[model samples]
Target: MIKVIKPGIQLTIQDLGRVGFRHLGVSRSGSLDTYAHIIANRLVNNHDNDAVLELTVGLCELQFECDTVIALHGADLKATLDGHPLYPGWSYPIKAMQTLKFATGRGGSRAYIAVKGGIECPEVMGSKSTDLGAAIGGFNGRALQSDDIIKITPYAQPWLYNKGALTPPKRKVIRLHQGPHHELLTPECINAFCTTSFTINPNSNRMGVRLDHNNSQIMQHSLSLHSLAVAPGSVQLPPDGNPIVLLNDAQTTGGYPLIGHVIEADLHQFAQFRTADSITFEFVTLEQATAAKSKLDAHLSQLKLSLNRYWAN
Candidate 1:
């Protein structure tokens, strides 16, 4: 069990997210950084879909009430337990009443904390993820607050020491697939979209990330289209032509024109971008995107194998 002493900027429980309910007007609410969330859970021997604490911009403080193993991943927020620095991608033992705190993240936007048996939050729509816009799922369907007590479920497997800390692969350029309307735009506009660097706006959230391309003419362009089903990582261009990347908590449908879609394997890293951070996108063919995803799966399989080897010995 753990008690929330301070509920950072925005901390909530998240899992893989709810699905098969889009027809009911419900959006799939889940961890924005799905890769990090799954890795954190696997580090502690929890299922990949287990519920974990998703900390936005860090700044959370909590007290453990029992001995348990936990892992942190995603953003490097300079976290510490009882003043000692805690490393991500590694499991650590937390003694009873030990307090853990996370400072502001220096690089990424969100961090994930996974316990041994995952968080014991009630499942709504088949997931523990909190959807703030709809006020459903997670801890009472809202963000955690100070004085809230989060219960930790008992683990089925015994606590075991596994591999040492892990280092996430460096993100150089995000790969994007051409959209359905890629041919509609002029060659110069398309080239500008791919070559120019865009800054992440401060108004970014789970719903979507608004990007600033610094081109007034692009924003002046307008388009009209009927609303269509949208998915995570879909980069939509509004009437103003600026891109807004739909994220985990984005609406079920949108009328904006889609400019492109970020590759699935890189969406987690994209979710961790902070405001004003500049990012460049590189276009890739569908076959190339598939290969990239396959490579990512291979890497994760290797990590799992390493953990099993450590436990076997």
Candidate 2:
């Protein structure tokens, strides 16, 4: 069991989230940075979709009640274990009753910590992710609080020491594919979106990220459209003209014009965008998007395969 001494900005146990229940008005409320979440789990030899602790911002403090292995990834928040520096993309051993803490640092906005056996939480809708909007799954369906005890599920596999850091490139140019309403914006607006840099709004959250651009420089124009099915990474242009990138906990449907969709491998990059950070867009063909996703999938498969052999031995 791990006890939360201080649950920073937001801390929650999250897995890969619900896969087939989005039609019933459920958002995919999992880790915002899925790549980092899965990498942390992989480092600890856990399943890719195992529930791990998602720590947002910083200042989280956790104390281990038993000896276990843990891995952390995404957003280097300058974490420390017993006053020793612990970095993302690395796994470490914890002694019984040892403490871990985090401080504000440079990098992404969130980090994931995965224990060897994953977290023990009541699965809802076939997932163990925390849906703050719906108030189901994960530690009573909300951000963890101080003094919360998180139990780890039992595992019998022999512990293996795997040392490697998988770092996905931090890209300011996000790849996007044309959406159904891609033409809703005038050609000028589309050009401005792809060419100019937009700063992330402070109002952004797990649901979606609202972006801002200089009003005097770019035209704030978007044609109205009826509400339709929208999923994570759908870049919607509201009437006000600021683009909003839907994320893990975004609404099931949106009426705003869907200008583009962030490609799969690059979608997690948005999770690390800090307030006021600038990001540009790059329009990609469907073939390019497919190839990018396939490349990432193959890399993940190779990573898992390399570690599986060690564990099997």
Candidate 3:
């Protein structure tokens, strides 16, 4: 068990998110950076979909109530255990009554903390993710507050010390595939969209990230489109010409024009991008997107296999 000392800016429990519930109008609210979330769990020898705490903008603090293994991943967040610096991608053995704290780190906006056996939270809609919009899951379906108690499984495999995995490359260039409403965009609009760099707007949240097109227009001119189904990573162009990259917690459907969609493998990178970060889009073929996802899947599979061996021994 652990108690929240400071709840950071926006700390919440998340798994891989709600699955197969979009039809009921529920967004898949989960960790924004799935790569980090899964890696954190992997280091702790937990299942890939185990629930962990997602901390945004750092500044969270927690005190452990029992001995357990823990791991950190995603954004650095400059985490420390009992005043000792802790690095990401590696597991640590934390003693009872020890305190862990985090400070803002460079490069990313979110970090993930995973405890052995995962967080013991109630599953809502087959998932332990928090849906802030619906307020239906996670710890009472809201951001964690100070003094809140989070329970952990008492029994867990012994902590195994191992070197962390290599960090993923920081690619500010996001690869995108033409979206369903690609036809609505004129050639000049498409050129401008891909050629110009955009800054992530401060108003972004879990639902979507608003991008300022650096004074460039998203479309050469206005073209209205009817409402259509959308998924995470869908890049929609609203009336104001700013592009919004819909994320895990985004609405199921949207009326704006779909210009492009970020590939699944790269969504983690997109999620880690912080406010004011500069980004540019590059178009990719379907085959290229498939290959990238396959590569990442293979890497994760191997990492899981490595961690499994440690636990099995």
Candidate 4:
């Protein structure tokens, strides 16, 4: 068991989220950064789908109740375990009653914590992800609070993982895939969208990461139409001209004119961006997008095989 001392700006338990309930207006409320979540699980020898703790904006404090192995990934939140600095993407043996703390991180906006057997919670709609908008699933369907005790399921399987941490690549240019709605943007606006350095808005949240393009003309070019299917990374230009990238908790459909979709390979990097971060966008061909996704998959597979390899005694 783990006890929450300070729950940070936002603390929630998440898995990969619900599989296919978007037709009913369900939002995918899983970890904002999926790659980091998987890596954290790997460090702890947990399954990819295990429920883990997602800390947004850091400043969290947790106390362990028993000896266990754990891992951390995503944001460099300046975390410390029992007064020793904790590194991301590495596993550590946690002693009973040891306290773990996180400060406001400078690099990214979100962080993930994974334990050996994962967090125990009633799965709702076949998911343990917390949908804060709907208030269903994960620790009574709400964000974790101070004094809440999280139960951890015990796993006794013998496994091996590297003691060293994986270094994540940093990216500034966001890759996008053109959708049919790309035609909605005027040719001038299209160039502006790609050329301009958009700043991440302070109002960004799980629902969407709003971008400040600093140009109002982009918003006037689009007219409202029927609501179309929207998913994570859908770049929508509303009346304000600022483009909002839909994320895990966004609605399944939206009327906002979409300029493009962020490639799957870039979602993890984009999720780590914080307010005021400058990001330039470039649209890529479908072939390029497929190749990028394949690259990420190949990397994950190699990492998994290396970690699960047998070690000769």
Question: What are the lDDT figures for the candidates, one per model?
Answer: 0.84, 0.88, 0.87, 0.86
* Tens digits of per-residue lDDT for model 4, 114-170: 998899999999999999999998989999999999998644444354464564576
Residue 99 displacement in candidate 3 (angstroms): 0.5
What would the per-residue lDDT of candidate 1 be over residues 1-313, giving only the tens digit for each residue? 8999999999999999999998777888888888788789888878999999999998889999887889998888999999999977888877788999999866788889999889997888788889999999888889999999998964434556855545457574888988776776667677778887888889999888888887636544566778888888888877676789888889888887777899987787766889989888899988998998898888788888887777677
Quality of model 4 by C-alpha lDDT: 0.86
Lowest lDDT block of 10, candidate 3: 213-222
Model 2 segments more than 4 A misplaced: 154-160, 215-217
Worst ten in a row by lDDT for model 1: 154-163
Which parts of model 1 have CA positions greater than 4 angstroms off? 154-162, 165-167
RMSD of 2: 1.8
Q: Estimate each model's TM-score.
A: 0.95, 0.95, 0.96, 0.95
- Cα lDDT tens digits, model 3, 94-183, are 888999999997768898899989998889999999999899788999999999999897544555577486556778889989998888
| Residue pairs in clash, model 3 | none
Q: What TM-score quantifies how close candidate 2 is to the native fold?
A: 0.95
- Once fitted onto the true fold, the runs of candidate 4 whose alpha carbons sit more than 4 angstroms away are 154-162, 310-313
Write one digit per residue (lDDT tens) for candidate 2, span 1-313.
Answer: 8999999999999998788987899888998888898989999878889999999889999999888889999999999999999989888888778899999776889999999889998899899999998988999999999999999854434455857768678899899999897665678878888787899999999899999997524546636677899999999888777889999899899998888999998999988989989999999998999998998888788888887876677
